[model samples]
Target chain A: MKAQKFWPWLIVTLGAAYFLIPLLATFIFSLRMRRNEYTFDAYVSVFSDPKFYATFGYSLSVGVFTIIVGIFVVVPAVYFVRLRMPWLRPFMEFVTLLPLVIPALVLVYGYVRLYGSSSLIPFTGSILGTDILLTCAYVMLAMPYMYRAVDNGMRTIDIGTLTEAAQIMGASQVQIIGNIILPNILVAILSGAFLTFAIVIGEFTIASLLNRPAFGPYLVGIGTNRAYEPAALAIISFIITWGAMGMINVLGRFAPRTSARTD
Target chain B: MPAFLEVQNLVKSFGTNTVVKGVNFAFAKGEFISLLGPSGCGKTTILRMIAGFERPTSGTIRVDGEDITHLKPNQRQLGMVFQAYALFPNMTVGENIAFGLKVAGMPAEQRRARVDEMLKLIGLLGFDKRYPYEMSGGQQQRVALARAIAPKPRLLLLDEPLSALDAKIRVSLREEIRAIQRDLGITTVFVTHDQEEAMSISDRIVVMNSGNIEQLGAAHDIYNRPATRFVATFVGQLNTLPAGVLAGTPGERAIRPELISLAPRPETDLTLTGTIADLHFLGSVQRLRVDIGGTLVNIDTFNNQTSPLQRGDTVTLHLAQKDLLTLGA
Candidate 1:
């Protein structure tokens, strides 16, 4: 009859296990060197290899690139649609969420068909070709998360009031967007950044299709070459992603309450 | 001589139904006017139109002889306070009050001084560092008031500012608002559903119903001589009876509860015999409901000079002819 007594603890325990199991399994796999030997050999094998550092370094660069590009592309686009062209919201939202419905691998295949060297656009022939392809794919894959975050953020404040207030004060449209609107929605932008980082770092299909040396492809390459090292790489990528997200959550704890709504 | 703010034949229709139908009024400089009506009346729509938030279907709004009907809310140079206070939750009290000045690109020192002046005016000088959530409802409203008046706009519009507050705070804040408006000598238009609030604070009250102005006059005149049946009932309590029996036309008689007195005197022009249906003791005053024929008429009498009348006693109701408003059928 007293549901409150048992339900909360039960739900928390189950939720913790749901998230912790994968982490624990990864840790256990990383620790095992042999059937009987429990050592740091896998970690050692990973750290000593010259290629592991290069691959992880490439992954880090690509993830950071993806987040920066995503922020630049998404914030203004979503703000424009939400504020000026609200009539196109349903169409824009559907287009952004289309990536979620299409599998990442299938989407990457489409990107290759559209922009790869042998495809219609032949976009990879340019000087910035490979990184460009990788960045485009990352932005596409990470769009759903970023758009939703920014849209939700924009919804919290009185957009009309903020814009009107700034405009009447002699602020141009660009200044209003940059100074007032963007700063107000900084938290959402940061959350979107963190999410984009997580997605791009873990993504494998787009990089493999485009022949880009991103972290996901690098991990897979190392996995086939060295068994224990792949586990270590997986652990490293997991830590990077988890650490970034955890930092976001912790920073979010001390964030102003208005951050959830405005910035 | 043109009025400071002029609205001519304003109309606003949502879909098929018109919320504000051909309403018009004007206000001179330093005049305090109240648009008094019940909920669903077009008082707020009219206010919004004047503030340039809503575009009228057909009309013109002129401020100081300049047409501003198509201007934006910000371009009209008017400050408005919403019913919910609408204080920016992210800003401190000082920042919230200084928002207009900050927008206006005032120098920091001048802006700071103006913020301080507004805070002192609202009696919240020490609350500058506080955020909106940290303050009580009354304090938050004072901050909102300070914010609106800080800009020193040509006209100040208040939309039910005191309705959100408790009774004691509402009275005090209303008095403070009236005092500040007087001190500033700014033209003002306040919208309220509360008749008491309008009557107590406004120099003139515009009583509206179904998107039309029922009566517009000085507060005392509006209260004393309500032009229509609805105005009589809406502005104050009234005793409505058939015209033949109630001394008025068939519609209603807007009679103040305080205006009708009870006595055994036969010299009164309006007299009726009825049983005392109920008696209520309201501290200094006693309320008696007398049943005359089938209609119940209420009367208020001072309790200090006489012993309280017991319920179920037959009493004679006496009313002055000048105190009752007779409406056209």
Candidate 2:
């Protein structure tokens, strides 16, 4: 019994140390911007910088767009497939997973190849077109997580009976989707949104290649130009991503259990 | 009187397999009809067709002279309760009950009052704030019932609403559902595989087999005068005895276990000597399996015999001519 307990404790301690040590070192180094005596000058500098506000705000809005697009694209596809065309699941799963197997750089390059200048649809010709292209890319990138989260959340409740119940009671299509489907899967959607937000905020390749001033490229710009502020930015980025993950975890606990599944 | 709900020539086919083959039935207003059948008998398919969930391949469904066969489910003004767990888990009991009323654009005060009335009808008047997951299965089902009827829909459809609960709750909830239906005077169509539940709750039962309705009548008629052997075997316990037991006839006889008695009476039409094969004590009734030469027949009698009869004991089984069933093929 003691030996069994020892192995898990040792494994957890090692795992925690492996992840926490680098973040702790970066945090400690970030506090040393003022030399011999420790200070929060690095963090203060990152906070007060005008570039930080512009890039962070831009990234935040882009993340929101990506999430909205993801919802509009994924929810209906999943709902329709699960309810009406269930045989399409295996094919849809493979399509959703393509984002994971195909690297981000390859996807962006393919986008550039297909929609570059002198092409039929020159998306990269204008800044707005480029932003739209980037948002679409992010939607594709986050498909795996968003699809699974929505599907799992949907699994916990019987949507078919609920839809039928609502419909027979004089609820139209919009009312059924808005009042019945959305509320039931709200937790899953939020979880997926937060995850997509975290991914978008720190994403560098697409935003940089598209010449957009996203926070990821700004972080790289700072890292290459300065020393201590880079650590501060890294810590801040870690906090934001961790906060999103924390929200996902906390919201997951509130989703109704499947024991009362009605179908 | 014109039938309030009329189903004419209803047929549904899924791909190559035909489920409901041109079935037709109609009931008057305030009638409680149950579609009773075994699994895969197209009973639920017919109910879904009526509810507008499944489109009939042919024929039309009319309610009060309005043809609603092509109408969407929402436009049909029907209240439906599913088998189990159809209550919205995210909403409270009050919200669930008031959902239809809210959708219908009822003012807040009226919706709240109607919700409270439904809660009171279901004996859960004070449970407005309770979410579905916080309640038991039976309570949640009752909330679903309240939700379905709060809109005072034109017709109420129940698709095996009490099949998920335990035996005790299933019985009591069904009784409560029947009483509530009577109180509201709503025309209701229920679907269930439990014949006893249908017999007790429905004004008339439609006994279905394969993809067709084998018999449709009151429970007493369905049991005593079954239209077919499928109805006889499906509705109740039936024992087939050789005709030789009835003073040497050619064909077999179908009789219910309880119709045959151990004690002979003045009106007893036939008496057969048989050896007691097995005895089953079913609380108020004891079922006996008797062997009369090569034929075996089941006999049920009152459980008044304190002394247990041995398997080899000779006993005389009594039957009445009126109790013998005439079933079609």
Candidate 3:
């Protein structure tokens, strides 16, 4: 019994060290930007750069757009599939998982090939169109996470009975989805949104290929030219991801308690 | 006048498999009817069709002489309680009860009062602010009932509502539900696989099997004079004997286990010799299995302070001719 308890604690302590040691090293290295001693110069330099704000702002806007579009498209698709077209569930799950199975570079290549200037629907013709395309790509990339989260949420509540109950209470279809279904799955949606945000903020291959000035491209550009500032930016990116996860945890507590075990 | 709720030749088929095949029944105003059957007997399908959740492939459902077969569930104005107590986990008990009233655009004050009235009716007056997860299964089911009836629907539908509760709670809650239904005098259709639950509450019990109603009548009538072999055996415990073995015509005969006895009595018209094969002690009663002429017969007798009967004991079983139910083969 004593050995059983000791093994788990030892494994956990070792795993923590394996992840945190490199992060601690990077943080210490980032502070060595001053000539002789450790200082906050690298952080200050990265924070003061105007390019940082522009790239971060662009990524933030794209993240928001992707979330809104993802929710609008996925929620209704999943809801209808569950309520009316139950036979289409396997097909829907297959489509959502396509993002995970197909590599991001391969997907972007297809987007570029199909939507280039000479194509029938030339989405890359204007900057705004390209941004829209990029947002669509993000939505696609986050498809698996978002769909699984929302679908699991829908399962935790009795969707058919709840919808029927709501309808019996004189709610229209729109009112049922918006008022009853949406609120019940809000925590799940927010968790998906935060995960999508974390993924979009640091994503590189698609944004760089699309020629967008997203945070990923900016991070890569800084890494190529500078040393300590790159480490500082990496630490900052890690903190942002951490913050997004923390937000999900905090929002989860506020969600209505479901007696059904979602796992 | 037309019956309050009339279901005529209702048929529902999914693809090629027919679930409810040409079913028909009707009841007057304020009648409490139970569609009782074993699982997968299409009792719930009939209830759902009546509630407008499933559209019948053929036939019509008329409420107060109005054909409502094609109406949506929302427009049907029927209150339904599910087996799993489908209370909204996100809402308080009060909010759940007031959902329909709020949707109907009732004022805040009236909705609150109605919610309070419903909670009081279900005997959960102080549970308005509690969420479903915080309550016991019985309490959650009562809240679900309160929520269903809060809008004063024209009809109430309960689909095996008490099956999920404990045995003790199921009995008490069913009584409470029946009392509430009577006080409101609302027409209700309850569905259950449990015969006792159906027998104790319904004004009329519709015993169903394989998508057809075997019998429909008062509880005692259905129990005492089952119209079919399915109804006789399904509604209660019975011992089916060969009609010739009991000195009757050549057919099947059904007799209640309780109607037979261990000792010969003056009321008994026929006595059979047998040896006790097994004895089961049920509360207040003892069930004995007797081997008579190479056939096993089940007899239920009252358990008293006298010495209990044991297996391998020689016994004589008594039966009255009137108690032997001759069923059509």
Candidate 4:
């Protein structure tokens, strides 16, 4: 009995150490920029660089844009499939999973080939068009996560009766979606949004191929020439991902609790 | 004058299967009627048609002389309480009750006052701020009721609203619902499969089977004078005896177990000899299965302080001639 309890705790401690050690090592390495002493020189050097602010800001804006486009595309498509065209659910699910099945590198390659400068819709012709193309690609890459989250959220509530009840109350279709459906699924949407933010912030393939100075390309550029500053950048990227996940956990508590109590 | 709610030649079919086969019924204003049937009997389908949730393949549903057959659910001005107590999880009790009023563009102050009135009507006066998750199922159902009726809809529909609750709460809440319906005097169409629930609350019970209404009458008439073999067997517990055994013409005879007695009495018109096959004590009454002439007949008698009859004992059972109902196949 003692061994049974001890084994689980030992395994959990080992797993925690396995994850935390890399982060700890990177943090200590980032502080060793000043010769023979620990200091915040690497962090200061990275923070003072104008490219750092420009690239990070660009990535943040792209992340937000990707989330907005993803919500507009996924929420209504999933909602309509669930409410009006339930027979098409399997097809929609299969489409969403295609992103996960087709890797990001291959997808970016297809975008380059199909939307090249000579194509009819030359999305890669101009820098602005390429950015838009990159944003669309990120939305596709995040499709599996976003769709599953919203679908699971929809499963918890009875969309049929809720829609009927709302209609009986004289709410228009837009009002029903805005006031009733959106609020009920806010947590799921936020969870998907945060996951998308984490995924797009340091994405490498599409942004690099598109020649955009996103944070992922910046981190790679630094890794080639600078040693301690790369470690500093890694620490910053880790914090951003950690912060997004933390926000999801905090906001999740506020979502409406399912009333399963029969007391 | 036209009836308040009239459904004419209502029919519904899904794919190749016909669920409701041209049902027709009407009710006056302020009438509490129940559509009672087993599952797949299309009772709920009929109720949904009336609520404008399901479009009837062929029918005309008129409310106060207005043809609402093709109207949308919002235009129907009908309220519905679902079997699952579908209270919106995001809203508080007061907000849920005020949803219809808010959507109708009622002013805020008036909406608040109306919501308070509905909350008081449902006996949840101080529960305006509580979310549905914090409340019990019975409480949530009351909130759902409040939310449905706050708009003062032209008609109210309850689809087995009490089927999910416990026995005690089901009984008490059903009575509360009946009392509220009486006080409001709103026309109501309730759907349920439980016969006792229908008999206890409805002014008229429409017993349906296989997409057709078997019988429609008051509780007493439906129970005492069932019009069909399906109605006789489905509405209550019944024992079927061969026509030859009852000395009747050439059809099956149906009799209620409670109508039979062990001892002969002045009102008794038919007598039979049988041996007791089994006895089941059911709190206030005892049910006995007797083998009479190779046929089994069940009889229910009040449980008295005297020692009960034992199994395998030969006994004489009595039944009035009027109690034996002859049914056609």
My TM-score estimates for the predictions, one after another, are 0.87, 0.94, 0.91, 0.93
Residue B261 in model 1: shift from native, Å? 1.1
Deviation in angstroms for B70 in model 1?
A: 1.4
Instruction: List ranges where model 4 is wrong by over 4 Å.
Output: A1-18, A101-131, B247-251, B263-266, B303-308
Q: Is candidate 2 or candidate 4 better by DockQ?
A: 4
Candidate 3: stretches off by over 4 Å: A1-18, A101-127, A208-211, A254-256, A260-263, B247-251, B261-268, B280-283, B303-318
lDDT of 4 by residue, A129-229 (tens): 99999999999989999999999888878888899888877788888888888899999999999999988988888899888999888889999989899
Model 4 collision count: 0
User: How far is A51's C-alpha from truth in model 3 (Å)?
Assistant: 3.1
Q: Which DockQ values do the candidates obtain, in the order shown?
A: 0.26, 0.55, 0.40, 0.68
lDDT of 4 at A127: 88
Q: What DockQ number belongs to candidate 1?
A: 0.26
Error of 4 at B53 (Å): 2.5
How high is the lDDT of residue B138 in model 3?
Answer: 88
Tens-digit lDDT string for candidate 3 (A1-263): 58779989999989999999999999999999988899999999999999999999999999999999999999999999998999999999999999999999998999999999789999998899899999999999999999998998898778898888788767788888887899989999999999889889999999999999999999999999999999999899899888988998999887777573211
Per-model RMSD to reference = 4.2, 2.4, 3.2, 2.6
Better model by DockQ, 3 or 4? Answer: 4
lDDT (10s digit) by residue, model 4, range B14-121? 988999999999898989999999999999999999988899999899988799999998888888899988888899989999999999899999999999999888
Predicted chain A of candidate 2: TM-score: 0.93
Residue-wise C-alpha lDDT for candidate 3, range B78-120, written one tens digit per residue: 8989988888888888989999898889999999999989988
User: Could you tell me the lDDT of residue B129 within candidate 3?
Assistant: 92
lDDT of 2 by residue, A116-212 (tens): 9879999999989999999999999999999998988777778888888888989987788788888889999999999899889989999998889
Tell me how far the alpha carbon of residue B225 in candidate 4 is from the true structure, in angstroms, after superposition: 1.3
Off by over 4 Å in 2: A1-6, A109-127, A258-263, B305-310
lDDT of 4 at B15: 89
